[model samples]
Target: MAAAFHVRSNSFPSRPHPQAVHVDEQLIRLRSSESASTTSSSCIGQRLCDLQDLYDSLEKLLRLPVTEQTIDKKAVDKLLDGSLRVLDFCNITKDALSQTKECLNEIQSILRRKRGDLSSEVKKYLASRRSLKKSFQKVLKSLKATDGDESLPVFGEAEALTISAFRSLFSFMSESTTPSGKWSLVSKLRNHKRVSCEAQTANEFSELDSAFQSFAENKSENPLKMEDVKRLESCVQDLGEGIESLFKSLMKYRVSLLNTFGH
Candidate 1:
């Protein structure tokens, strides 16, 4: 007998944009013997498509100016909507991965029971499972750090920090940290850490947090000047590069793991 699984694309909530990009729902039926290979490949394909769509949306959003006058609020809202869709899709992918991992674990357990031993192939399969989980975790962390929670600021505090970091990165701001800009002072309250684990990224994020706090203190603000807009644009470009690198690493590992099932 074969088992059947259906993966559906999630529809987004209404926003400024009336329509969201369309993604197809996929249904895959797997024979008992083919369950591992078939399900893994099908799910991987669906996830990849969703991720590509998200990357495209972000790339488009990245083009908009940060300042008020020239800024395209409509485009910004559209991109925000797209980001929410991506978040939903990633959650779906995570669920599918969980189920797949559980299925593999069950099979591994049964094999161990029947043979009273684990073979070389079984060991390799288990290793792949662990690797997949780690890779997926990285993907989730990076996306959440960039996408941020739903709030008025659009770019969440973390994103604000990222923007702040970019200003310093481009030498648009002084290198000296404002009193509020210290990581311990600012980041201790935040739950999420910097997207990348590296020290340099962390330092950049710290700078951003400080800069954002300073901005907050100022209260009154003006539309971004042209120079500010250009600087923020450069910042987004830097951020996008990092995001692309993370996604590429995740895709490569995930595909490699699925291939272990000989897809």
Candidate 2:
């Protein structure tokens, strides 16, 4: 029996598994790239996708029996706590994204009718955007407050990276919605010329803001363009989809951790 077992063990060499360090490295590279890149919708969408991929890899690593065995109860508790906090962040982000999309849809609907004045709808949309921005700012503040609290040997690196990514995401969202002096800048640009360098360099949200601002200021002369609304809608749709996927991944990771460590 011993000879047979020994032969079987030799026949099946141990398979190599993914290491936490590898995921940590990927997260680091992602963070570095994100910092250097513009916070355009495309870049943010890609960040969301990359974050989901990292979480998928993390789920696989955590599911490994060897990895789970190495984590003590104390570590598991810490991970669980962190996981819950992340889930909260994910939920809040999803809610905000949904609200923003709804506002976009409402604006598009109003624009489609070629109505006399879109000031009311535009005002509503801008108000919604401001509210969402405030929500994101609050979430970011909470995230910042909890930074560096997690120092677990096994999972601290992953948790820190996750928090950092969320911070970047929320910060981008906040800025995109309500950049400082965006209204003043738009107003100045409108007085000088219809299109300028500033408009060319602005992101989708900024462009949408300018469109709405123009429509509100001079509805009869400068109507809310359907094309601009459509473009903003597309951008928001992509972001919403990305956030939804990331939220699902987070839930999966949290559930897996709970199943493994909740006992």
Candidate 3:
């Protein structure tokens, strides 16, 4: 276990690349699994390092005269080739990172626009809110039965409550030292006093609050609210829309995250 932890904390091994590009303005897109993370960033950092090493070595060689083949031509060629391979990997890493960033950005934009539709400053839309509540309830019900083709990660209840306050899913893949673990993402934390007995690893949508909270980004001290709508009706409508979109985004995120870690 300790060894696994060390592996998580350690950097990825620098892989070799062949026939690397020399362009300065190039950028790579990020993969969903790699976005908003130190793990992916570490790869980028290593690539930069390899590039710098190559530059330095070339500079030294330029200044030094060719006397009796310094350290054998073949060995030098191999070293240079290894460095070049790493450089190529770095380029690919950059592209993957960029793509992930773009995907996250797109998801955010959709939510933002939907949020914009919720800016009416009134609070008495219980009817509309209730309608949305029902829609989500139905969605949850279906999920509870495992009524269709699917799998689910039911984070036990206690941990979810913590998520409610924080509004962010902690990345085990990025932070975890090991590649494997039994509780990669716990559904709940049981030690807390407020957590209910029913917060066990249930399959129902009763887990919604905690389950949903795990995917939220970091929450500030002040909670988010709606703003800028022509009427309270639109605000209410937008609220439902925004929430629906949120559910969609989270579902997507969960899948992407699993796929990433699975790889």
Show pairs that collide, candidate 1. 181-210
Query: Cα miss at 72, model 2 (Å)?
Result: 1.3
Q: Between candidates 2 and 3, which one is better according to lDDT?
A: 2
* Among all candidates shown, the one with the greatest lDDT: 2
Question: What RMSD value applies to candidate 2?
Answer: 10.1
lDDT by residue for model 1 over 1-263, one digit each (tens)?
A: 00111111123123322111221111111111112322111122222333344334323333322212222345345334543444443443445334434534544464446543333333443354355446555555555576544422222221222222222222211222323321211121112222221121223322433433443445245211223223322333333433344255334433432333223
Candidate 2 structure lDDT: 0.64
In angstroms, the error of model 3 at 15 is 34
Most TM-score-accurate candidate: 2
User: Which 10 consecutive positions of candidate 3 have the poorest summed lDDT?
Assistant: 150-159
Better by lDDT, candidate 2 or 1? 2
lDDT digits (tens) for residues 95-145 of candidate 3: 333433343343335446755321121122222223434543543444345
Candidate 2 lDDT, 1-263, residue by residue in tens: 12221211333326544455567666676666456534445555666666777777777777766666556676667667887887787787778777877877777776677553467778988888788888888877787776856343335655666687678668766665444322212212112122222322236676777777777788788866787777766766677777777778877877777787666
